[model samples]
Target: MNLTERLAAQPMSNPRADRVKDVAGLAGRSARSKRGLFLAEGPQNAREALARHLESPCVDAVYVTEDALGRHPDIAALLERVAGDRSVFVRLVTREVLAAMSDAVTPQGVVVVCPSLDVAAEEVLAAGPRLVAVLARVQDPGNAGTVLRAADAAGADAVVLTAGSVDVYNPKTVRSTAGSLFHLPVVVGADLPELLRAAREAGCGVLAADGHGDVDLDRLQDASAARAAGAEGVDAVYDLARPTVWLFGNEAQGLSAQEKALADHRVAVPVHGRAESLNVGTAATVCLYASARAQRRGADRP
Candidate 1:
């Protein structure tokens, strides 16, 4: 029988229980880093965390209020699916206890204690990623998380958060990802230049998304067509279909001259509207999808 079919061996009813305090403390970075465990709250986050449990086996424990199992059949089904796993313990938690363990204003009655999702920059690069997103000193959790989701939607191989960037494990950041955090390998706290070096060594053309760039994104999109047309001098530009790593800078400051220059091309998202400019999140979506589309079209180019 699956875990859903069976009741948890123990029931945790105290909101001020010692275990509740310990789990709630995971909101802090030091606690998470030292303990090598983090909290995943809500039905969505817990479900995704459960999905990747086998690969990393990060799910240490799961707590669900009775209401949760009844309200969210999907979550109940997921618990049943992984019931045989000895590493993760599924238990019945009081609604108050679930609220105490979560940072959300309205707790979803489902929470998971998981390990930090950190991977070595070298490990992901070893796979020869076709697409990567490098977040350099991105302080805003929303922007950072949105970029990750966009990267995943664009089929990026992995995401690297530079040393000065916001914590990928921050509760707001984790929630902002909408569960995409579990969908791909995310490398955090790495030296930006070294990560760039690894991507370049893997034969990826690193493009920095700078609004004031000399080359527009539309031009880069035309490179594949130019290559097929036997056009003159157009081959000098980047081929988006080839392996690529996109470097996006901080929300307010954007990239410095040196950082922009490091990339094979400094790219700008074309703005036809009267609006001033696109934020980092919108810009990344535009750039990444542009690459995805270019690579898709390049495959069919005669």
Candidate 2:
């Protein structure tokens, strides 16, 4: 019940102990992909997970070292409150072992293992007239996380990543989110066509970003009919509050011709500076925020 008892009670070993040989081993898609689980490392993410546990209990385990205990005594109180919950597991490790299991130069002395959500197309579709980001094979971990974080900050309902997008649960991605991951629903391993179909069915418009698109993002903001919705039957209105998926493609190739064809509108972010183009993540942020602002404007309209 007390802080001292809680700290002393953290399990040091289990009846059936499983030793993780290397932190890098858990980085692969196969292990994480198969288990539908991922690791969140560092003080920030671990602390965020603890905060979530305090709020509604979203994580499975809190693994830490003595150094972490020394630094963050508050976590002991958090662990004590929810430790009896079936999903909550707490463990303490040696500093050397913690260092081996950490990816950072300076390990924050704590990490969390949590369930990776297998978001359904139906759920995404059900969020009608919602703002969503569809990441198509975004490779960079930081970029992918930034996009998700931005989407959440902009009030996008959810983010659906195509089959090839970077792992949303990567340590760097989790860190970059800065706890926005907890604030939004992120669907990974979604099929592009199925997602597109859901968007259409839900009366959501798909806006694919392309450097060559005839329509500019500003036009969409103004609610102007610069580009007509395609024959796919998606909504012509680029209403962010309505179901909308802002499609962002790979960093190197951009959106494929077929992918662009599926979009109800293809809009480009106008750039005046010498930069060739915006990064996929940056471009996504600009587009998502614009939709968020426009959606707010629409809400305020009448």
User: Best lDDT goes to which candidate?
Assistant: 1
* Cα lDDT, model 1, residue 146: 96
lDDT by residue (178-200, candidate 2, tens digit) is 77787777788888998898788
Off by over 4 Å in 2: 1-6, 9-17, 22-24, 54-57, 69-77, 222-242
lDDT of 2 at 292: 79
Worst 10 residues of 2 by lDDT: 224-233
Best by TM-score: 1
Model 2 has an lDDT value of 0.75
Backbone Cα, N, C clashes tallied per candidate: 0, 5
- Could you estimate the TM-score for every candidate? 0.93, 0.85
Candidate 1 wrong stretches, greater than 4 Å = 1-10, 225-236
lDDT of 1 by residue, 1-302 (tens): 45744564556889898999999998998998899887878888888888787566778899999998899887777788778987787889888889899988888888888888789998999998988999988999889989999999999999999888998988888888888899999999988778888788988889999988878898877776676555667754678887889999999999878778788888889999987788999999999998888777767766
